[model samples]
Target: MPGRRARRRPVGDALAGTGRFTCGVPEAVGVKRPSLDAVRGFDRAVYVVAVGQLINVFGSGLVYPFATVHFHLQVGIALAVVGLGLGARSVTTAAGTAVGGYLADSVGRKPVMVSSMALSAVALASFAFVPALAAAVPPGVAAAAGVSRVGVAFVGVCVASGFVAGLYTPASSAMTADLTDAEARDRGYALLKFTNNVGFGAGFVAGGVLYSLASVSVFLLDGATSAVVAVVLLLYVPRSDVGGDEEADADVDSSAESGASLARWWAAATQPRVLALAAINLGIAVMYAQMQTTVPIVAKEGLGLTAAQLGTLYVLNPLTIVLLQIPLVDAVAVWRRTRGLALSAAFWAVSMVVAWAADVGVGPVAVGVALVGGHLVFRTVGEILHSPLASSLMSSLGTDAERGTQLSVLEMAKRVGIGLGSFFGGLFFDYGLSTAWWGVLVVVCLGVAAALLLFERSVTPRENGAFGDATES
Candidate 1:
């Protein structure tokens, strides 16, 4: 009654006596709740794409986790060869990203995404069928194909998959940017990340199960999911020009250089503020790379953990993210994005130290577990702080006309971080576990924090406004 308006009626009237309470009319409600408003305001394409992502990622999950293992064991490729194949994939992926970004800007986002999905599906299918085909060849034909043919074909397919992925990444990212405004981009991308991880976790488990059951089934299912995603996009995503024209912004940026070179793909990406943020991102990514290369080796060899025990630790990272990502993003919605990023970097930095200290005693396994769990919690906390805000920040930095090109550059920076991080992490580990886990990682984290501070200072007030101006709701 306090919050609602009531109509007066005669107390003795039968109608009044029989009436059940109806509090407020729709028109009388002055504003919608934030949750409802958020749902109502979302671009239909975002939801559609989210669904497609879930399907596609789950499929990818089945094969990606087992790729190296499959090549080495089932395909009988040497471990070193498999490693070489992976490196080749990364190289193609980087090149593809650059080209994809340019195309997303030149043509459109949806076409590039849909086409890439379809192409990737074909590549995945080849991954499944090529081995069987190679085996079935006549003796003479098989001789012509050579003993290494199966391995070569699989690697080629992997390379193609990488290139296709590159073609799609910029378009997909730019599409999300096109659909969201600066204000809503964080939540939009947050939801996307949440959806993606859910799929990723599911895929990780399911892929393992399928791999054990039948190795090739993983690739078949992965390819099927890709096809399904392509179909879904074709049916549901709108075809309108989503990446808005920002010719004026492009003109402004171009004029500052006095002249534009035909070969200067980096022109839009070289803004001082953009470069600084990209550097900080690269640093954080280097720290992140440790989870894959450094953490597992240390856990097994240094901590005396079993393979199963180590797997459990790996699971904790995404599980924590899937459960807490949204709440964490919402919690920090009131803080400046830059400040939030710095806080996350600190958490990540401290987590490495905690993990290092946990190994001092070789005490109770439970104690080790507790310490590692604490590290995971903090790492995920940092992830929550970084993931959504980072996407939104990158999106906000780009103009409409150059969004795809600029974002591709950002993606390349990330790839560079991963490549270099893995390289340095292995080098450090070779020297000493402490050197890699403590010295290198800690220094990188500090650099990330410092870089972020510099970025905050160098950028205009508007750039830091994501949290300051974000409505509480």
Candidate 2:
């Protein structure tokens, strides 16, 4: 089998008097470099696409959390009803992303991406009218009394909106990878994630305010912003002239994929190296999900904290992520990938234990307790370390054109992990005292084990031209 080509070495080539390495294509945002002029303005495109992402995701940050609460209480919607709505939206998003991922492979990353964003705009645009829709109901609903059916109907609207978001991620991630070179990949992805978190934090606060004044306010704002995002993306996002990363002349075995090397995609997915990365992603996302869901439950019920206090802890994370990600990213960038993941998982284990004790010494007053403070630092640190690495590895999955589908599949794996993890964890935790913390501990441990397993098992595999250059099996 053909193997990955040796890495691009500008210095060595220059010393040897080889012009091939001396005058190469310019570097793209997330990739190491590009060989095509079509991909010339990749950096600007990322920002434009990011606008659409932020517009949709900011609304997601606010509405997803609020919908459950609103439906379960304010709308007097049954718990089953709320669960079904949430689950339906999740399935919709998953299906949409899966389809979009394939389309990215078949057609091209840009058209699939821009088209999805446009549809997303339509979905969000409908949200602005939710208030008027709610008003048509009985006085109990319009009056904003407890548990209005009208409010539940609006939650249904949000469910539809979330489906569109699901379709957008894989295409966007693929486009980012397509536009850049290997070296810049991590930074580009980190920047995108940073923007997402910043938007999330602001939206969280804004959602509460908007929802209180008019349940539809958040939707209206989100919808309009999505429209603006679509416009920006259309004007600024690069066209198909831009292709994916440059192929390595040596290791390319282009028989596996369709337009892509199908065998290459197969090798990366099945190979120990790529599979290990997938496992690690699954483990990390599981732990991450618990922080929002289980950890809070333990704090509120077991430790006895008021809703406001618990909420403060939740809100603190977004601000903390935005501030620390830059330095953390830089620091991790200095280390080899293995060292970063090991250090990250080690700290993550500590965060789980911290939750076990957050309520320990505080007695009845939730005010004085700070058990979770340490966990915040650890969680953020772990996230900062893992995110860039994950992005880098996933971006290395396929050539430029196939990047979205490959990455999208990886994302789907992550979502599957998160979905099952939360489901099982919820079942396990609701059974006993401090049960969730213990479960989290178990999950973190499993992540560490998987990371180590991958590290131990990595072996290079034959791949297509572009991906073969930047990544090994």
Candidate 3:
């Protein structure tokens, strides 16, 4: 009996012992059972973080959509000045993300998250007081201040808030990766994005009503929500969920050993695949940036639509995401991620073409509405395909020690792309080339799609479709 290699345990029995799969009588009899944990797509810690993010993003939605309006109308600042302030905020946010990633690796994830949220709350609360404070100053002193006090205060708050956002991004992303294993990470990220859109959509509607009834109240409410999220995270989440160097001697040793942290950071930055993915992400981000900046402007001016009509049409984006994102995740569970990304870009390209048609006035009002609706639906599909896959891919690129830095680098690329997109978008519009802008974006998207295919070939076989059930190895 001993020489018989001991009758091999059934696959179901072995897997059940690992606690990764469910075992039933049928499974014990050699049938395979699906994993319940994989189906749920989250552990307890990740769920807590997702809830906090939902609350935080809801607060952001309550204020961000109205930031430019607040600066231009209530504070009596010029549009150019408001634009400059927003640009500055974007730049600072980019820098903040880079710095935040380094800190997330050196310090712990929880500290960075908690501190960022707390600081963001302070900065947001300060917004409500800026107009009042600016008005309180004497007219002569206000003139002596060069730019208006309101502008200065507003820009300062924007800079501060952007920096805090940068800090939070890498920390939160790395924490999510820490809490989720590779198999479930795709669904985890998709669920997070889903919650974000849900929160933003609900807050957007409520913020509109609140802004009309009492504009100042929106800022206060946003700040209060940030405070609540910070508190919830501090009280509920455990530090051990994301490992940290607890001993003072270990920290000193890490620092004393010829800057080991810096060496690791440099290694992460130089990873060929990481850089390639970041570049692709930058291109995607540029395309996505149009939605927030150029799309609305083009929809209104180029297509001759009213503000209300544009808002109504834009609602389709979030609606599609909420209804279809999870189902799409399940539907595409077997897809190679590279193929999914390429397909996403193709969708964006088509959407851009549709947008171009609407901009050029190629049809009547009813036809134009249909074209724009189709454009939104296609763009939303691209986003659904891209976001979760990109996040999961980046998270897979490095160890826990290096994951924060890698994700940060990816985020920085996105921020830079958004800045470039906004700049180029405005430049094109100003130069009376708005119609051509969509065509250019279409080209960019197609190029990205092609590049991703080449990228897929360049990576190792195991890395090509690691997220799906059919890994080559």
Candidate 4:
């Protein structure tokens, strides 16, 4: 046989054409099988980042969620004041995301990432150290300041941490894009999302135990992990070239690439389909916010369920992702991106209806089971479909040079979603929890789904770019 074909092809294409094996045997054995390596191969940075994310997310789970609780319970701050502090944190995050994305493109992904993580550790340390400092103040000074000093310091640190996280994410996300080619982007993101959820679920569960032991320990542990992750990125992950390097352009077929210009950024910002997708994502996020707001209150107060039960309901979403993400990614790998997103939005809508019914209480046992089991199953499916697919879409739509800026726009939309979701969810809850969940949220999901499907149809074949559309025909 000839050693070479008439034309060159990618290794994956060559392997697919060969069909030399069936589950480790020759295909003449009466079965044909595809090589798994084609799907499994990825840049080393992907795995390293995945591990770093696991550490950072787990450490975050151990403390971040409980920060508000700590302020309210341990520090004697009012719930309203704690809410204001958190709200301010969200605003700072949005600002940081804008700055980070610009810097990731202008400078380099690694520098921004390492600096952000290091700063995050410092912020967490501030949280850990302030209480101790407050305790040591002279009695006269301590009496004069009371808990106000500690509260002020804690809120300031929380805001700083949020900003640092904003800086870390776009760089990290852009770094993922830098490492993997278009072929591996979906699987790479799926793996990243899976690691994040696993770490988060475990962290939230373990955080309870840590909180019981000592609240201060939570912040200290979170800070330590952030520091470790920063070191790992600095030492292990190979230095990323600045976004416009010659090699990076080769990866994207940079025919469409142009020199750095504000016009390119403006073009990406004004792309109709991209903006539509971002808006749809924002709506979905607003619907999701109810889980943090109206859902838990109704589950506990309306249904007479314990805090443990509500916590279980919350855990199921991440648990499902951790267990099923890879399998689900493989399952939908052939589907068109738009169809998957439409199906996901449908699932989100359905889950909201289930939550609404559960809130009204069809039956104690049945409602509890539906709220825990049904909602988790449906909502997790939406999450599995949406998260990786959206990341891949963003990767596809962007030019190599403008990728960070494009992603920053998407992140900004998410922040808007969170702010709007929290504000509206709170206001509507005053009218009635049922009105809040079913009337406001369920409707938003349906509208977003419809709009997403419309955009799906409008996605021209040419728009598929180097990362071809995977949406079902």
Root-mean-square deviation per candidate: 10.3, 9.1, 6.9, 7.4
Cα lDDT of model 1 by residue, 187-242, tens digit: 67777877777787777677766777787888889988989999998888875364
Q: Candidate 2: minimum summed lDDT over ten consecutive residues — where?
A: 31-40
| Overall local distance difference test of candidate 3 | 0.72
lDDT of 3 by residue, 1-473 (tens): 12211123466654443232344421121212224333363556677888998898777666655654566656687544565566556667778888788878777788888888898888777788877766665667547756677776666676787777788888888877777656556777887887877777666666667766777777888888889889998998766333343532464555565387678778997799999998998888877766755666556555666434555566677778887776675455555578888999999999999888877779887787788888889999999989888887788777878888998888888877776675577567657797888988999999899989988876654455342133355
lDDT of 2 at 328: 63
Shift in Å, residue 84, candidate 2: 6.5
- Please identify model 2 stretches exceeding 4 Å from their true place: 1-42, 76-92, 121-162, 242-273, 295-312, 359-362, 367-369, 372-374, 429-437, 444-446, 459-473
Best by TM-score: 3
Instruction: Give per-residue lDDT, candidate 1, residue 165.
Output: 74
Best first by TM-score, ranked: 3, 4, 1, 2
Deviation in Å, model 3, residue 412 alpha carbon? 1.0
- Cα lDDT listed for each candidate: 0.67, 0.57, 0.72, 0.67
**Candidate 4 lDDT (Cα, whole model)?**
0.67
Quality of model 1 by C-alpha lDDT: 0.67
Q: Roughly what TM-score does model 2 have, to 2 decimal places?
A: 0.70
Comparing 1 and 4 on TM-score, the stronger one:
4
lDDT of 2 at 109: 61
Q: lDDT tens digits, residues 1-473, model 4? A: 02211233576564353343335433341212323442356666778888899999888767644565466556776444454455556667767877787767766688888888898887876777766655554566535645365555555665787788788777788878777766556667888988988887887677667767676887888888899999999998766664533344354433444344456666766677667777877877776555554565565557654434444455676798887776676555545566677778888888887877777677875556666468767878888888777767776776767777677767766766765665555455555645554767778878977887687666653343222223323
